[model samples]
Target: LDGRTVLVTGGAGFIGSHLVDALCEGCDVRVLDDLSTGRRDHVHPEATLFEGDLCDEGVLDAATEDVDVVFHEAANASVARSVAAPRASHRTNATGTLAVLEAARRADARVVAASSTAIYGDPTTVPVTESEPTTPLSPYGVEKLAADHYVRLYADLYGLDTVALRYFNVYGPRQACTDYSSVITTFLEQACSGQPITVEGDGDQRRDFVHVRDVVSANLLAATTDRVGEAYNVGTGDSVSVAELAALVVELTGARSDVVSVDPRPGDITVSRADISKARAELGYEPSVSLREGLTQLVVGD
Candidate 1:
């Protein structure tokens, strides 16, 4: 990554902030974010921050200037939010992605898109692979799948190198502890504050919880690797039920809280895990942190 100028869209968001920090360790990094959901404080001082939306052509051009790689991480992340506001999600996740791709193409920068496991929809298989059929159930999922396809199309038709990383449940420190945020972050915040943990649905719904650190590593690898025009699953390849996750959060934080089950939301999948063989073989990516260890580090903080 040395001497590389990398542009990170949504660089002030949870995963994006971590990615910015990681990129700054060796590369000259620039960040572009609308700050609609991203916090200004999350932006690293080392990064040249452009406070604007990806859909803004001037903003995109400024951010991509002299950039060698682009990491597209901006999106409406919540399925529920997307359900309530499908148009908004499509504008940002789908259209915003096209704008980013155009900027990257203009700059002749390699692109690494932040895709999602939601693209797999309700997977019929235990461990979801990249080759599996993409049957996105929710607007958010469909938007991401479409963006991913655009990435591949651009790579093939326009000669732009692109890679899409289908991230599982990425969670860790700096994750927003808000209503419309990752489950792990939400649970951790509640448990740390000694609040009741709310589990939507039967609590049997499972997810592959990959740490933000590992996800960041995967993003960095994809940026420079030879794996273009392909998608890879970035996860720990392990599944844990929501019930089990809540229990673990309580245990880890030593918080007193009763788990409360609520009605399942729309587009919620019963279970999701990942097959990381493609990432390991192609990008040389492997998760080094266990869930327990990652959770502890997230709670304790460095």
Candidate 2:
């Protein structure tokens, strides 16, 4: 990242903040965020923060100016929230992405987008790969799929360098504990507070949890590497059920809390795991953090 001008959209968010920290080593970093879900405190001191919406063309222009690379992480990230508010989610996740791509194209910048495993919907297979057909069940998933397609189209038609990373259950420090945040964060917080962890459904649903640090590494690799017009699954390639995750959180936090089973939530996937061979082979990206180690850090703050 040395001597590079990097623009990180949603840089005040959890994963984006981590990415900003990683890129601040001899790199000029700038952040553009609406702060709807992102906090101002999460914005790194080294980064120039632009308080604006991504949908605005003027805001996009200001942020993309002189940027060598763009990390597009801004999005409405909840499945339930998207289901409840489809139009708002589409505007932010789908339309905002198009705006970002246009800005990147105008600036001739290499772009790395934050896609989700939700684009795969409920995977019938064990380990989902980049080649799997997208069958989005939720509006959030549908919007991301559209965003990924737009990224590929921009890469091919407009000759813009774009790479999309389909992240699977990213969790770590600096993650919010709110309803809009990741499930892991919410569970960890509850467990730490000596509260019973709520498991939506039978607790048999699985997810491939990747540490935010690992996800940041993948983004950095994609930004520097020559791989363009492609999408890679950034994950640990290890599936763990929600029951297992709750148990781990309880162990990590030393919180003696019983797991309570609840009714299943809408638009919830039964299982999700990633096959990260493409990321490993192409970008030399590999998840180095274990769930135990990452969860410990989240609980103990090392």
Best by TM-score: 2
Candidate 2 error regions (>4 Å): 179-181
Off by over 4 Å in 1: 179-181
Best by lDDT: 2
lDDT of each: 0.90, 0.90
* lDDT by residue for model 2 (214-238), tens: 9999999999888799999999989
Q: What does candidate 2 score on TM?
A: 0.97
Q: Model 1 misses residue 3 by how many Å? A: 0.7
TM, every model: 0.96, 0.97
Give residue 276's lDDT in candidate 1 (0 to 100).
94
